[model samples]
Target: MIRIQHLSLMRGTKPLFEDADLTLNPGERIGLIGANGAGKSTLFALLRSELHADGGDVDFPSAWRVAHVAQETPALERSALDYAIDGDATLRRLQVELEEAEAHPDHAAQGHRIGELHAALADADAYTVRSRAETLLTGLGFSQQQMNRPVSSFSGGWRMRLNLAQALMCPSDLLLLDEPTNHLDLDAILWLEDWLKRYPGTLVVISHDRDFLDGVVNVIVHIDDRKLKRYSGNYSSFERQRAAQMVLTQAMIEKQTRERAHLQSFIDRFKAKATKARQAQSRMKALARMEETAPLRAAAEFSFEFREPASAPNPLLVLEAVNAGYRVEDEATGASTERTIVKHINFSLQTGQRIGLLGVNGAGKSTLIKTIATELDPLSGVARFGKGLVIGYFAQHQVEMLRHDESPLWHLAKLAPDVREQDLRNFLGSFNFPGEMATSSIAPFSGGEKARLALALIVWQRPNLLLLDEPTNHLDLETREALTDALAQFDGTLVLVSHDRHLLRATTDTFLIVADGKLMPFDGDLDDYRDWLFKTRLSPAKETQAAATANAAPSAPQVDRREQKRIEAEERQRLSTLKKPIESRIKKLEERMGKLQARKAEIDAKLAEPAIYESANKDELKTLIAEQGACGRELEEVEMAWLEQQEALEQIA
Candidate 1:
């Protein structure tokens, strides 16, 4: 449990929280929500003790462990699995000591110490730790082979996944997760949601993903007016509750409005008269102190109609035996090799048709969408587009492609040189970029703002076909919902690739599964698609492998059924043999971890006392701190070893 009493906090003289009192009870999963820059991150900093409270106190058990994902991961030669397992501070500590003990060539003495260390490793469940880490890695979209890859090999997004896995790797009483689903696809997000629901610790997650919050969080902590308002349920419940409160408040404000107008008229008529000056002044002070309610600024509405295309063409697009993908170039040899991402995709789009693309990550959903958008030519067969076909393409990269030095006004002006400046401003205003914000450079804009600008640019052109790939990546719930509303009303043909289930469900009428290197119509809704994911796809790696085999198999196949079955059985047996030792190793590690964790708890208890820090026991305090630190290093080492075992198991699976 954690307690905050009249707490005040500031970020560079800006008060983020003032006289804020809140309580976080044991095992409560709370969703921290506010507008961006409303100090959600600052609140996390305060909890982490990186910032001191300006007033009052923040109190929690000193022995409680806190875990959060690191924002950056340095490029290193360490394998991804090892990096994740390093989150267990205790496991690493024990492993370090074990390494030293094994190195010292003292025969009987070294043997005894090594045996004792392995026992400690067993206590920590150190053996299965590797398997545990790899499970997290696999769930986050890493393959068995990728787990052994060096950290430096991955891109920024994958590294973020690594960082998240590391945080999840750590055993803690309190878990602080901020936007954990940002880089994840729909499938990964689903897996993570399930994982979080099973977590036993007190969890505080800060995310703009409303559906995710609804799925996992039980409590909503909203930061408003420099105060924390705790709501009893998830995001949807909070919305309904807030809406009801607003209605009641609005009713009272109507009566106050009448009173304010009467007082203002009285003061205006009497202030100039010398006889009424005292009374007017008294009224003025009363006006200042009156419990006034300001009108609620209506929610910023991103409401806009997509200008209908100049001409509607039947069958806007047709893919005839299309093989869509890329020709890869070998960097060193300057040799090109054709790589087919999606094979023989026979997809078509008609006027006003809406299609939602669904598949696991890297299943060529983007490839097929790109081919239809004419961004990439089909490697084989024909892609036919109707007359006057105009495409509005939205990709994840377009937001970063936005010129930081330019204003939203400038972006629109460039797209339409003939349009009047006022017209452009009006259009931008509809996107919620009003007043000075229209002219201001977007260098300081948040990701959601940049995305809106990009979408606004797309809308200005009035394309007949919309190709959106993960357009809601950084949008807040409000903006995403607004986009959903707009797209639902759009009169153009739409092909959208998004991990946001709510947006997909609301905006699309048709679904296509981009799996097995094929484009096939899915005769199901979003809920049906979820069921399909679990039933058809066992894992992301298997899905990709199956697709690759289907696309790359010989044109004339010779293998018989019995031969294939015999091969599969043999391979399964080999993997089973390979996994046995690894599983044994992980089990031993877990047992070792359990013991070390108990010992570490005892050391923490001693360190928690005030007398230990006093001059009377300074030496004892130093000795205890050192012992605690040593235990931490060993635990980390054991966890790393355990991660290797887990990676091996995933490879077999």
Candidate 2:
């Protein structure tokens, strides 16, 4: 187990944690979550012994080995597999020793040393380490051929994947992963989730992907208000528990405010009167002894909506035998060749439709989205757009296009130059850029901030069609939730390509599978997609049409239009009927829980008073204690009932 006690830490002048305490048990998968600047990474650094705590102690078993993904991967000529294999320091040491022993001049001593080295290497499974490294690379979306390529040959994002694979290749008792899903596609993310679930060591991951956290973590460690809070269960459970706590805190704050006001009023009215002077003095004393309840401070606040488009057009875009890809030119021959990605795509994106693009990395999801966004022209066939169609496209590279020297306000103003400056500021404020942040240069802003700015600029355009490719790459949980809410309520057509399963499920009603240079409608949800990925062994080399269809759920037979509409309507009605009562029950239980918690708090506060323990108030103290216990039991029952209702609602949904 790892124990962190009275752990005070500071980043320069800023205090990140003060007297924080936490205990992490062995083999526990923990999701470390916080706002963008809440020192999550710094805590990881402290755990890795790269940074020391200013006060208190962090202790763990001395023999435990820790592994973490390196932040940088230098450009090297070493094969990718070789670099990943080097992650096992013990194995590398043994290999080096074996080489030295073979070169030794003393024959007898060298033979003994070589024999010992061989036994150690066999014990360490050195012979199979290459295969293990290859598996890690494959799971991370690398091809078999790519495994032999030099580490310097991959791009920055692919290099990060290499770094992740190297970390996973390491043998350790504790593994630390910081945003491991940032560079992964849906398939790779799913694979990583499975891999982490099977890991035998303690795992601490800092990720904003809620589904990923829920799938892999058994506990959540939240950093808030300069303290570490441990919660049992997954991310969803942590959310429910935190929300209930907030509600109880707010109730206590309100009760304290009322008590304070009542005492103040009494003192003001009778402090000078001879008849009630003693009572007024006593009230003042009670007021002075009362503990203050601070107002709730949210970790982050961000909410924005896509403005209603000026016009809505049916069949907003059409692709007719479209081969969506790019053209490659030969410098020496002065000849160009068209490289097709998604071929023969015949589809129409209608108004108010939400579609998610599903595919492995490099399988051309981005190419299809780019084609629809008109960023890339269809190489072979005609691509048509409606007369009044307006496109608002967001991609990772668009974030790079943002001017570093410019402010959020400047970006918005440039898009809508005629709008009022205050209106623009208000718009930027919705994306969490308030006051000076709106006007300050974005040069020093983090990637999340830059992504938010890019999104704000897009929402301001009021486009009839929204095309997003991995828009949540740098966003934290709060911003992602805000974006999810906005996208769910959006009235425009949406075609999203994202690895975030939560966002994909929340905002998309349909899915399109991009594979083997073709696009097709997928009739199932994310779960089915996961099964298909596993069954097909998703990789660039194995991505064939036959393999994709082999494991896919059978397509439903076509029916009459009227019959199909009726079936869909009936299903909707049935779901609504099933959901309504569970939702109502949940609401009622929440109300009851709040009242019970507030009453319990009031009783506890009264019992804490010194006068309550005196002989005169002994009976009243006993009554208060009895009532507190009853309230506690009732609260637990109501909370359990609420949990059941929530589970039912989720199932119905």
Model 2, TM vs. native: 0.85
lDDT tens readout by residue for model 2, 1-653: 99999999989899999999999999989999998889999999999999999999999898999999999999999999899998999999999999888988886778877999999999999988876777788788887689899999999899999999888888999999999999899999999988887899999999999999987887899999889999866798688668767766776676678878989999999999999999999999999998797765677567889999999988898899999999999999999999998899999988889999998888899888889888899998898899899999998577789999999999898889999999999888878899999999999999999999999889888999999999998999998999999999999999999999999999999999997778999877897687567655643335344445566778934448687557655765677688788878877887787688668767866764556888998899889989988998887788677656654664542
Clash list (residue pairs), candidate 2 = none
Question: How close to the true structure is residue 486 of candidate 2, measured as C-alpha lDDT?
Answer: 95
Q: What's each prediction's clash count? A: 49, 0
Q: For residue 119, give model 1's deviation from the true position in Å.
A: 3.1
lDDT of each: 0.83, 0.87
Candidate 1: segments with Cα more than 4 A from true spot: 110-116, 258-290, 293-301, 536-653
Best by lDDT: 2
User: Which candidate comes out best when scored by TM-score?
Assistant: 2
TM-score quality measure for candidate 1:
0.78
Model 1, range 1-653, lDDT digits (tens) per residue? 88988989777878888899899899888999887777888888878888888898988899999999999999999999999999998899999999999888786688978999999999888999987887788788787789999999999989999999999989999999989998988878877876787788999999878888877877899888788888765687578657655654565576578767877987999999999999998888888888887654334455666887887788898889989999899999999889999998787788989889888878898888778877888899998889988899998688988899999999999999999999999999989899999999999999999998999999998999999999988888778878988899898889999888888888998888887777878766765565455544534355455557667848756558687656755755676588778889888986776566556666766664445788989899889999999998887787667655644554443
Query: Cα deviation in Å at residue 564, candidate 1?
Result: 19
